[model samples]
Target: MNIYKHTILLLFINFLGFKTFSYATFSIIAIDLHTNESGAALGTCYTKQFKIYTTKLNINLADYVVLENNGFGIMNLQSDINDFTPIWLSTAKGILAQDEPYYTAKVISKFLTQPNQDYKHKDRQILLLKKDKYNNITSEIYHGENVTNFKAGKIRLHIDDRFSIATAGNYMTNTHAPEIMEKAFIAAEGNLSDKLIAALNSIGLTNDLGDSRCRTSEGVSANYAFLRTFQNGKIKLDLNITTDEEEQEATSLLKEKYEFLQE
Candidate 1:
């Protein structure tokens, strides 16, 4: 096997030995077919206090969302975790190999559902997006059966055929959270980056405590949030923000930074 595949195998083996749990509450991945720009944004109730890793892999919630260069694709892994670096790397490699989003997702699903694995596949939520050979944007979203409640996903194409988006959320305060994001994105007026931020902000407006896990304590959806975009083989925008202050909203902070950059 080549180095990439070999490394993925090693990481998978190590994953079986490490036991860790982390939750990524909500996320979206999209591609602007018009401009060949692709990106991902996410918010999670996870905080520094939850980084109880027994190993040296200091992977954060944002690390679960992998973005490829040249607007090739993106991947988001959320819900229960167990050193998903292997899966993340494999997905990236698959994109580089020109594999279809569905094909890559199927491979990942097969691996996660293997009978010998101790980790339950049903506890995970995954999303994948890519451009096919014909330049058509495609998406695949998997909402594991055992993931937290109030979880759902939506894959939509812009009415104008300008873009394609996939969004999903778990442990949300409302079942319509994903739909809210979808509507906001489709109706938002601006560039791809602006639309993405709007989608996230819509959730915050609908319910700052979108991730119900933090509603009782932080009164916000998440402590960590990020938005990243790529275009023309370059990173056009990248924002990763975190807050420890009580009652502070991470998604709000992300929007603040984005607006600051715009100005």
Candidate 2:
């Protein structure tokens, strides 16, 4: 029903066992007008076991928000750490809608327009992204260079009237999450679901040259959510999985499905 309720449910289920897939590396949230739904996706690359766990959520009901990390992104996950960053805390809020097209921009504007004093991050950069109606994605970046006070700028991107996607991640310059997700989104025929799947697949199958530890014993996993409000006031939730042999083994151990089958 509510975002907090959904978050608590996710935590409950995670403690019940989905905790293994909680180590997120990169994430993407997509709102598709064609389908009148929104989905959140994430991917992790771990060297400890050579497995990448990916989960996609299809939301067609109420508004939703999510937080993802690569285990190294935060000191604790329970403290409302919602941004995609290396050892940073930020909240990502989304207005899941079926007909209202400006909902995504509204949420993003709210996030950036306010001075978030709750975050524990300093001397850090801010990244904002928005996809337009013509399928064009625009972005804005704010530098954290300061001499004294912490102040955020009020710059907005030119978001379109059609469907859109917003993605974020924490990594080095060469392995940045936004770049990877954007590439995958464009390559996947500009479809949110396919883009997320492709992004996760790439994260698992390929190694970032900038990440030397990715080949070591550091673990990686990803969790996601999808939400939307239907015209009939009906809510819909769907689950999809993408994985290889190693990921399959890990998910199987958690008693979770790892296939996007035609059912």
Report the number of the highest-TM-score candidate: 1
lDDT of 1 by residue, 73-101 (tens): 66677776544445555545455446454
- C-alpha positional error of residue 42 in candidate 1 after TM-score superposition, expressed in Å: 0.4
Residue-level lDDT of model 2, residues 150-207, one tens digit each, is 2222222222443344554443224354555556555665444445455444444444
Q: Model 1: clashing residue pairs?
A: none
Off by over 4 Å in 1: 1-21, 48-60, 67-70, 85-88, 95-120
Candidate 2 lowest-lDDT run of ten: 70-79
lDDT of every model, 2 decimals: 0.69, 0.35
Tell how far residue 165 is off in model 1, in angstroms.
Answer: 0.4
